[model samples]
Target: MRYSDCGGLLKISFLGKPRIEFNQQDITKEFGSKAIALLCLLMINRNGYCNREKILAYLWPNSNDKSAKYNLRFNLWTIKKNVGLDGNGNEFLCVDRERCSINKDYEYQCDIALIKDLLDDNIDDLEDLETMRHFFNGELLEGYYFKECNEFNEVIIYERNLFEVAKVKLLLRLAKQYENRGDLDSCLNTLEETVKFAPYDEDIVLKIMEIYELQDKNSLAVIYYNTYKNRLVNLLGTQPSKKLTAKFYELSKRPSKGVKLGKTDFDTNNKQRICIKTKCINGIKYFWMASVIKSLLEVEGLQLEDYLTDTQLRDLSYIQPDIANSLGETSARTEVPDVRIAVAFVKLIEKISDSIRLKIIILAENEMDDFSRSLYEYLQDMRLHVDLISE
Candidate 1:
């Protein structure tokens, strides 16, 4: 008898997947596929109704009217039993001599119905538009198929195609709304989602590249163009459009100034060398820094090595001894340069003992939480010169 936040309403979902719920509890497992199929048919029809003849024709075209009617009756009974009835023994379905339909008084919500309602409202309502966009998790009953029913399959396919088109339109509209408001980030996010649904869509790809260019992320623009081109060639065996190719060529021609970390001159062939250690080598800032550092090292005939591989860093017990030997066992465990990584790094330095004055670089200083900052301070206390760079 417990009710969900959605109240006591029966909720049915046919978009992307199929499910039936009452008061937030899934009851779909109680019904057979045929029973669910029948329910879906009735729910989709106008007025939530379908005639017995048409239902039989669509569901069992191979069978005669008598057999089809018998099967339909059994499915209806199963559906009713699964859905249950009111105190008056009236089922959720309203049944006439030759037709079956959902009872008008039944409290229920359907995803498709909600989508239709949203579409009927003013598209200017950004909230409603976003809601509509999210409601389309995927195509209608995406993977569900009715056996021996080509008509039913056709219906599902048609509805899926229609809904997919609608979803793309909705995304484009939402992207435009974001663009108009000068929210490039939101616009890019919307377009990214849209591209998933239409990877080969030149217009969307162009817009995404344009946004990246506007944001002064020319490298990202070039990367995206290359990825799209590879996908096009692999998937469609075609090349990018002339305009897109031209834009990509233009972006590629832009000189790479490389990432700048403070006012340090990397061009000098001084004896000083630097190694960067990061907790996680992900994210745009980390990537840029790594690229810049790599380029600088190549120019200066130097190499940066990882102190510990991901697996080695996971074992705290093994690293504790090495860290204690370097920073003293009495050092507060709260120190920066993670003891595990730092210890491994010190080992590398000792192994490569030479006359190379090495400096340590830590990318993304501002992003580090308290623990990371403590590690940085610990390294400084050890008299190891550490350059903390922030994006």
Candidate 2:
């Protein structure tokens, strides 16, 4: 059967929401709910055709055959009235006494069809990849429901699940491409979205943690590790793989002391010094330095409460600028020292411990910026023992 002899284009959108347009005008409302359901039924079937008897029974199962046939006729009339007619006054549906189907010759666009085409095509460009992603705005006819149409609902659910899986796979493919290009930020952003689709996928969680570590954001790496561990334990009654757990432990370890202070033989009063140096320090680095200090003090059996004030501990938990902005802020100060605060707390630890040892560990060989360079110069003038690590 031919339904497009009128030479105008028909568009049906069934992804996320369902709508029908003809010549760029919305004609979906012109048909009743039953009529739209009938169109969907025919569209979903491979042949785009259904016998009149089967269509009537599926749509109006409680009605007698005669009553159901009458309702089907009314629905068909409504559908043809809005969709069949073209600008030249031609029809798009091929109807007869035995069967109804969209005209095989009719030109049309459908989101489901688009998805199939995308799946089959060799996608080579970002524009096409983005376009394919757009087709899955949400589940099929997400909020549209017919109270008694069980068959239609079944088709909707099956198609929604199928498309959701396809969307996730596509996202993973795209994210891998970003990772391959060393675009860590974009790779991370994409994976964050992918996690929403497959929240329990430990592989995705591990990839995110790995990215955080590569960025030198050990604090975030630890946070994601704990979050995923808890999710797995709570939801699945199991723990993450030992390999992942071991990696987490490795990342959480205190930074190795690379510099050695001279022998403690000269000090008679039992006084000691502690120093930390980094060419560039952001919020993550600052927090990591604090963690290392805490771990060192714990190893020495020092009581944290006795050494650092509550305010100092609070400052150690200061929020990173990116995190603060993500939480939405009206005004936030940027004057907080990215490295000096860490130094101040180390000094506090020194003051509280007479037998402490001073050792400076520098993470970067070259200063990152002007401010960090100045800090490095100041530390140099102090003649502190500095150990610079090669990045």
Give the range of the ten consecutive residues with the poorest summed lDDT in model 2. Answer: 259-268
- Worst lDDT 10-window in candidate 1: 262-271
In model 1, what lDDT does residue 201 have?
91
Predicted structure 1, TM vs. truth = 0.59
Clashes of 1: 3
How accurate locally is residue 75 in candidate 1, as Cα lDDT from 0 to 100?
91
TM-score versus the correct structure, for each prediction: 0.59, 0.58
Error of 2 at 151 (Å): 2.7
Stretches of model 1 off by over 4 angstroms after superposition: 1-8, 81-92, 103-107, 120-124, 259-391
Scored by CA lDDT, what does every candidate get?
A: 0.63, 0.62
- Mind giving the per-residue lDDT tens digits that candidate 2 earns over 51-125? 888887678877887898899989888887777555555567888999888775666777776566566574435
For model 1, how big is the CA root-mean-square deviation?
12.8
Clash count for each candidate, listed in order shown: 3, 5
Candidate 2, position 9, lDDT: 61
